[model samples]
Target: MNRLFDKSIVLACCIAAALGLAVDARLVAAFCLGVVVASLAEIAQGERARRASEAASYAYIMVAVFAPSFAPFAPLALYDIARRVRREHVWGALGAGAIFVCALVAYAHAGALPARALLLTAILSVAATLLSLRTAQLEREQERMRRTRDELQERALVLEARNRDLADRQDYEVELATLAERARIAREIHDNVGHQLTRASLQAEALRVVHADEPGVAADFTDVKRTVDEALQLVRASVHALNDNATDLSVQLERIVEDARSDGGPQIELEVLAEHAPANIANCFAAILREALSNTMRHTRAQNVIVRCMEHPSFYQLVVSDDGTGAAKTNSRGIAEGMGLGSMRERVEALGGTFTAGPRAGAPGWRVFATVPKQQGDDAR
Candidate 1:
């Protein structure tokens, strides 16, 4: 748009100058025609068509040289040639120089034009050419700068995303480390302090038995034994609480899903809604899920598996299902009992939970369902 406006201003100035120099209507018409041809050549698309259009524009300017009065408007075509010559085209530069020489020769031979008028025309033509070349150079520089700015913006966005990912990874690692530290503390307390308290309680019981005949001494020893038992129970509860708090059920589920994915096996979707499940319940469910997934991968040609762990007001539920034809075959061949199904059932029943594994009743797949009541899970813990 800027280039067009510049060309428009140059064309208007040339026409005004030509009119001031007393150019006739015929010369003005020829100059406008040459300008129109040069503009068309500038906008031409293909190589061959552009070259042909340029040739036609040059022909018009050469013919206009005969009228000498058209000299003021000659800068229009020279401007375009100057821009093209800046591309380092040898033929274009030679052609432009030849045309300028011919026009000067014609102007010098025309007896009506003075030396000063000829000199002014030459100066005007050179100024327009140099202006056009500078404009082209500036446009190239602007385009290069624009591309560089866009590349920098893209790189900045990529780096910002990477930084965000790094921050998330750091937080995850910290949480895992914290959980591991808590578990270690709980184990240390149970192994060292718990054993010592149990031993003290047993020693107190032995003293109570040895002094059974002495009523006062036996009573004192019995009281000491009871106190040690209570302390041991409190320590045990504290250790259990620490271990439970350290267990992140959701994180464990996610890890299981990630491991399944890394195996390049069936696509597994796990939805764990049991946010505050007991540690025992969480461990039980995780074990069941791992076994279920293993069985699905090993025995079934399943493309998709879905595992859901949900906590209800009354019970916690775990369901692992797979869309595979192998379920029906396994049921028919009684192979489900041999594929770790017994272990899953025993784990659930030991916690007073119910377990079932078979083909889905109303669906074309296999479903493993287990539910442990909240009361049972708490008692187990």
Candidate 2:
């Protein structure tokens, strides 16, 4: 658009110059011919054969010098040539200088204008060329700055994404370390303190047996034995609690799903939304899920399985479902007591949770659902 406006100004100047002199049909035709050829050359400046366009533009300027009325329009072609020249193109510089000198000579020989008019035209043409060169330089600088800005923005976005991933990795590492420490603590208690308590209980039992003939002594020893046994039970319970708490439900479920996938099992999707589930609740759900998946893989020709564990305000729920025709057949035949379904039911009922397993009512699949009241699960633990 800027180039077009500049060309328009040059054309207007040419018209003004022609008006100052006598206008004739020949001069008008020459002016029109020069304008059409210059416009075509400008339009083709970026084509593969742009050298041809440049040659044509230079040729038109040389021809215009003989038709003095069209001489003023020569600057349009010179401006394009000046803008296109690069520092590396030494031949291009020589060609442009030679064309300018030739045009000046042609004008001088024509003898159609006074020397003063000719000199003014020469000065204007030089000024126009220099302006074109400066404008082209500014455009190149602007394009370079734009590319640099885009590259920097792309790099900044990449760095920001990496920072977010790093932050998430750090958080996962911290959780894993905490789980490891808890497991270590549980092992220490079971190996050291729990063993010691068990030994004390055994020694008290032996003493009670040794003093069985003396009722009073036996009674005291028996009481001591009972106390030691109670202490041992407490220690075992604490160890079990620690071990349960050390388990991350989501991680365990993910490992199970990944293992199943690797073993050529059906596609399995597991989602655990119980972020802060209690140890006993988590343990119950994990055990049930393992058994449920085992049964599905063994008894059903399932193509897709979905396992979801969710925590509600008053209860925690787990659902394992699979899409398979075999499930409905199994349901119709009646699930045998020998199957793992009995064990799943026992685990859920022990925690005061409801358990149900059957073919879906309207869907073509099997669903095993269990829900334990939050209060009962915590109390059971």
Candidate 3:
């Protein structure tokens, strides 16, 4: 923009120089010459506004450039130049000539020397003013263009930042899930294969003691066979869980609750605010509720549990409350607890949703609220 304005201002001054040095009629003709360039520029732009306006602009510019000696018309001509043409050759020529004509008239009447001096001073003053206005306009336009470019650049930066933030958050979620799955795998190894191997080792030692002499290997073989069989069952169960994520959220929650009960972990009373929900949302709610209840059993002493799963067309809400005790009494999300409900909160939040857990209002228990985005829930489903 600055370059464009500079070039235009220089062009204006060059045209003005030709006019000041020329004879009067020729000065007018030279100032009017830019009509050809303006018309061609308008044609190249294919801008109807410029093309439609060519005639009026040309007339105004020509008048502004040549009307000085034709004065009282000069100022009107300048105004018309700005209004009709917006810009043209007249500002320098006519403006300079007006002053030159007056100064020359006065010097000659008063009998001052050679007409040359008056013409030089008057022409210089007009030339200086025209170039001055041109430069000022250029500066203002440059600043405006700079501001617009900066604004567009700022918007692009903001979008890129948001995109990066979303991608980082997604990567973090995938990492967390892998870690959780690995931990479950470790637990499986401990519970199934580890125990079986230990039992087999013990039985082998017993067989070693009992049959110090004959076919002792038979007993050890029997124990090894039994342990391997049990290990196979455990492996199959883990595979089933991995493949069957299509189960409804409520069913998963019930399974978790029943498992906790069987383990004699904790007694929890669960309630559903909706009998059936959109199957998609129903899953995360189920997970969130299950995790909340798991934390209640593992971490809290409060007994009574009430889980409300609310459904709507566009969104869903879950409130898992446990009378086990308050947050003030125990931490649901401390590093000491490692990967439990805190991890659950992180999981829910990653789905572009909200998860809040704290002490229940007016109740001495912890309340867990998890709301997953409907859009993400649909994808999950």
Candidate 4:
């Protein structure tokens, strides 16, 4: 609109010179000055400037029409008014154009100007108004298209983040279930097979004592007792290995931390209070560890991270902290907005536990802590 208004000023000057050549050059100069003054208001930035410009423009059109020489520039004035003036005030432009026509016709009839010149002036005014409306329509359409493209790009990014969260959750669930099953099987072997082997070894020892005087029988019984003891040792060792593998939370966390450092990620520390923990709690803690590591790497600019898993008599707790500019500034919105941290909170809450995350107190960092109740099932014992 501003560009068209500027161009219209030049066009108006040309039209005034061509039509009013015989009139005093002073009147044409006056019309040019009036248009420039009105254009100043039209091209202004804010609403107040535009409204003041509109009043100035109306004054110019009303006074200019009384003289036949300045009459040709009326349409150019109408064009500027239509483009810059709001719709509610559009009647002002139409009324001004009407008055210009009536005055131009009266002047022409009184021999102030030719009939053909009046016809040309009316046609130019109508054409200019129509052209201004078309330009406004094209500009509105372009703005709408730009907004739609931005919205679609934002939606695509949200969907991609959700898909990744779902994939990670699914993998974590599968791994936890497998670990639980292994722990269960290991318990059954230790309780049933381990107990029977102990009894067999005890009976063989008694037989060796009773047959001590018979060389062949004593030697055979001694060999049986030693073999049973060795078999029992192997079974106990196997059971321990299975249990260790099932709930190796410390080892698992350390590996994750080490891998991150090796890949040029953050400096991380892992601490484990006990060598063994309940499989269910350990599994959940491992998931929490993986997610915390991921969130820190992806979202924070922290240089150092600390991950700790500690087991008590009745509960197990996991804490992941980082020395980054924490999300606590945004409060709940920061922790709840993202899928990764939100899911971690959900997992902890579902297990009847407490989950908390925010800026570390009196420090420049974020802290995530969760404590899950210990379940007294086979794995727990």
Candidate 5:
């Protein structure tokens, strides 16, 4: 709307300039020449230049007042003056009003206009003043609204970031609580149940010493001692498994292989390419190793077993291979005959890991391989 008003004013100036060409051509030429010069000079560069341009515009208005047709352009100057002049300045306000009144008086006297024409001109001029004031007010309101919208958008972004930080903190706290509980359970089992198993094994040894003269009774005492010793080893292994820690992974794997070899199960070979791993990766590696070895011993009368562990920048891997009679194929996974293999697969894949177990191609043996991520921050889900 503001742009349209400016264009209308420019159009009025051109029409007035053309109409003045016939009535009193010499006076009309002087007025048109002044208006053109003032309009051209209005395109000022700086503060000093703008003040000079304003002075020239006022001079052109005084000269153009003689022609009744050039009356519409008078409001353009009044609008500019109203904006720059404060209301408290009485003299400035009166000066602008006097210039507008003089232009109306000169226009009314110069031409043989009717009384109705004079009244109409007065109404139009007053309406132009009100329109200029309204346009300025509208511009201020628009600027205020734009600033309000920008502030709202910035506040929303800040709130979203704060919410994300709160969620991350909550997850961290829950993970800490879970790890603490597991360690506490492992400690209780080692302190209470382990002590009873050790005492029982010692009692059986003393019984065999006391019955040294009787061969049959001594043999029974020897068997009881051996069984107690085996139970103690099993209990220790279980406690170690419960207390899952990253740095303890290599040590636990070694113990598992040693126990199997000493029990006349298989000639086992172990290789660890990387020892350092995150807690989740280390736990998964230990679980897969235990399950695979158990399956090889129970299902296949394997003569030899091989286990390998490797660590990469982002993940850890485990491979267990046994040279024995491979299990027969069924509907589910080849190793799904027992719950251990299925459980191990679920554990590995739960942490964005992969697990596979099957008979080795072109070989009379079975192999189990798995890879788990070093950082499974989201848990099983």
Candidate 6:
């Protein structure tokens, strides 16, 4: 709506005015001359914007200045009047008013040529100033929108960061509980299944020794031996299943690492120091490994990784490190501080243990050392 009443629109109406005024070809010539001159001024300014307004404003001003006393077209006069509503263009109307006044005064007793010149010049200057004000307002609105867009983008980034942090913390808690449960299951299997199998094997051996002394009991001894063999097979299969399940912890750790790495792929090295570690200790260490690996991949620029498992009398310790820049070198979350030191401590303490994760004392990378106690459940007593 605003654009429709711009200086260019006024200029078009002025052309019709010039035609209707029965003004000589010279006046039409004057309108075209003003257009070319204003366009060159706009070009010389090197702004490229508001060309239509510039041309029209100058043309309209010329007609307005010359029209009142010289019989300007009614439509062109109305166009200029409409432009006064534009806040910046109010001044253009003022200038046109001044010129129109002067023209009326001068033409009353002055030569036609001088009267036309003074009236048009005043009107032209007024139009140009008003158009410039409109252009300024539009630019201000555009700048305001741009600022709003930038601020929204910044806020979105902050929200995304907080969301990611919460997700990582939730994952850490879930993995800790999983490790504890696996340890409990392991204890149940070893204390019950393994003990019963050892007792059956011992009984079968004793029966065989008796069979050697009594031929009549030889068949009974053979059956006892066969039963022992079947029991042994079942025990072996159970152990194998436990071993298969053991690998699941490692797989889960790798998945966490992958999430941390996101775009980059993480390479993990897992080491087990105690092959017969208590289920609780082993599973806890596996969870720690996963968390450390995730931090390294997500935050560090380094690539290579090493996980070391150390055995103790009543506890197991795992130290996960990477060849990357380590925690101290970078301020942003590096391997040692990726999930945050507080979360790491919680994981170890949750299992009645202690954990320390940080740069390896002056070493090139970071390390996480978690020590969890060994406990027996239903069968230990």
Which one wins on lDDT?
1
Model 6 pairs in collision? 302-324
Instruction: Rank the models by TM-score, top first.
Output: 1, 2, 4, 5, 6, 3
Residue 40 miss distance in model 5 (angstroms): 10
Better of 5 and 6 by lDDT: 5
Cα deviation of 275, candidate 6, in Å = 21
lDDT of each: 0.79, 0.77, 0.56, 0.73, 0.67, 0.58
Off by over 4 Å in 4: 1-43, 67-69, 84-87, 111-117, 188-245, 248-381
Clashing pairs in 5: none
* Model 5 misplaced regions, further than 4 Å: 1-69, 83-94, 110-121, 208-381
Model 3 root-mean-square deviation: 17.9
Name the top TM-score candidate: 1
**Hey, what RMSD does candidate 1 come out at?**
6.1
- Write the residue-wise lDDT of candidate 2 on 1-381 in tens digits: 667777787677666555555668777776777677668756774556578767766776767655676666677777777777877875775676676667676667776755655665676677768877877888899899999999999999999999998996687678778888998999999999988988888888888889889999989988988888898889888888888778877766665666667467788988889867877777788788888787777777888999998989999999999987763557542563356778888999999999998888898877999999999988875
- As a TM-score, model 2 comes out at 0.56
Off by over 4 Å in 6: 1-8, 16-22, 33-143, 146-184, 215-222, 248-381
| Superposition error at 297 for model 1 (Å) | 7.1
Candidate 6, residues 71-119, lDDT tens digits: the string is 2322233333433345767676666656655654665465544444444
lDDT string for model 4 (1-381, tens) is: 545554565466446444634657755675576558546754677878877776666766776676566666666566667776577776777688778878977886797766666677677667767776777677778889889989988998998899898896676567667767878999999999999999999899889889889989989988998999999999998987788677767656665665677556778887889557655566667778888777777777788998878877887789999987645434533654477678888777767788888778998877999997776322443
Residue pairs in candidate 1 whose N, alpha carbon or C atoms collide under 3 angstroms: none
lDDT of 6: 0.58
Cα miss at 150, model 6 (Å)?
6.1
* Residues forming the 10-long window of minimal summed lDDT in candidate 5: 326-335
Q: Considering summed lDDT, which 10 consecutive residues are worst modelled in model 6?
A: 69-78
The segments of candidate 2 whose C-alpha lies over 4 angstroms from its true place after superposition are: 1-5, 8-16, 25-46, 87-89, 114-117, 211-234, 244-381
> Candidate 3 residues 203-293, lDDT tens each?
6666766675666576666666666657656665554444333334555555556556644455566655554454545556766766777
